[model samples]
Target: MVPEAEFTSYYGRPIVKPSPWEADIPAYLFAGGLAAGSSLIAAGADVTGRPVLRRAGRLAALGALSISMAALVHDLGKPSRFTNMLRTAKPTSPMSVGTWILSMYGPFAGLAAAAEVTSLLPEQVRSRGPLRLVGLLGRPAGLVAAVCAPPVAAYTAVLLSDTATPSWHSAYKELPFVFVGSASAAAAGVGMIAAPTHETGPVRRMAAAGALLELAMEQRMERSMGVTAEPLHHGKAGRLMRAAKVLTAAGAAGTLVAGRSRALAAASGAALVLGSACTRFGVFEAGQESAKDPKYTVVPQRERLEREGPVRYQP
Candidate 1:
């Protein structure tokens, strides 16, 4: 019997070109999710009268967003390239929509953080005109950021899945959930780390909920993706994914019994943050690896064709 033929591409090159993005892109993805999650936490804390948690969440949102934008600009090799994306709006384009979301979110997040900072000013300075105005606007700004948070957290997944990359495209159904959950967990981590232990009840709940959602979505994605999921289970991507699962699970469990111990809360918070980062990096690497291997691209097409049969042209 003849052996099944091996799939090969021209000159042994990848069937699909891997994205030119570097490590900065993954950092950008992680930071963006962190910012979105933090904004939501901040808004919730504000409504619930958790001043310490509010301040921490707002500050973390702004800081993470700044890092995210900077990483994106650095990856693009020019700040102008980012701004250029804003010159036109394309409803069908995920990149365009994501850019617009970031543009709207940044100012609100910054304003919220700035308002939070005004409280840090000396009493006399804080009581002054401009600072007082900023402080007064804080609630509104934070609310706006919260309103935009879900889209910001999920848009990166949309952007990735919209790409031609086999792993990302194949996992589109669950990628957004994974990203949003990761964002929430990371944001909850920030609150746990920075807020008073007494004020962390909501944050702990959020952490548990987010971690569970992320874990479930990721498992579903892998199961549904078939061969495309292989990249997520091997090499550097596999290592990162394994670390992410362990850390996220540990962090969620720790939050259940963290109680009033600041050390335990902080440690658990750190684990969640690290786990979220690992997840982003792992997903990014898996997509890159999948794109590099022709089998990932060609086999999926072949299977789809086999399952659906060939398209017929109409007269």
Candidate 2:
């Protein structure tokens, strides 16, 4: 049985201080992942000429990207000092690289989303020369963004991984898969809600891939952290992840047979959405839970400290 415990810092070093950033930071991370996934779905629809899905996916991507930008800026320690983020790009540093990627991808994605909207307009409206010009130029932008977007989506996991945040850093492999799956699910959810489900073949495929990867990573993550993984396998994270896996599996399997019928599509979509959101929240909660525990921090530190004994004073 677990002993009654009081919270203490990790090795007496702060495990977490309330991040000074506003809610927008986390909100934006979710939104941005959604945008990246949606854009990829939209691109797939564009190739398949499923204008309904294409348009809806594009719009969702754009709206989410815009919101993400706002949230990211708001999260900057010194919003005014944001430019300093550009000073360098270190592979070991996820944030620095992420900032650069976002800088390049955001506008291009916005433009791509805008171009997709033209496909939905009346021919007369879409015929406007300037809009046509924008559409032509934006086409490449969308493709570029989509190809690049997956990394951007994955980078969030890396960002959190490098931090002292519990479970996040140690569970690096699993975290990226989690984000990837969640992003894909989010994209499918938007497509199912706004577009005709009959043509959501691409979305369904993405959902299948997402669900598979998430479940696999989660299992591996659980096994990877013999001791540290305790927080993830217990409490809210475990419960939520368990629920997510069940829902995601059910939803993906349903999609395999959910042909044309709108009802089946909607239900599957909802399940996927719930699963994805739970994954994100579970991850966040798990990190916090792990951080709050002394055992998680102390045990790891003690191992490290033992490996390298305390510094000796020079007489």
Name the best candidate (by TM-score). Answer: 1
User: Per-residue lDDT tens digits of candidate 1, residues 168-263?
Assistant: 999999999999999999999989999999899999999999999999999999999999999999999999999999999999999999999999
Q: What is the C-alpha RMSD of each candidate to the true structure, in Å?
A: 0.9, 3.9
**Colliding pairs, model 2:** none
How close to the true structure is residue 259 of candidate 1, measured as C-alpha lDDT?
98
Misplaced by over 4 Å in model 2 are: 1-23, 77-84, 87-90, 119-126, 233-239, 303-315
| Candidate 2 lDDT by residue in tens digits, 1-315 | 999866476476656542343456557778878888888987888778888887877788889888787777777655655568877777777888888888788888888877777756888898799888777876688778889889878888888788776577778867888788888887787788778876887788888888788788888887876577887668988897777788888888877788897788778888887787677767766777777666676677777678998878999
Candidate 1 global TM-score? 0.98
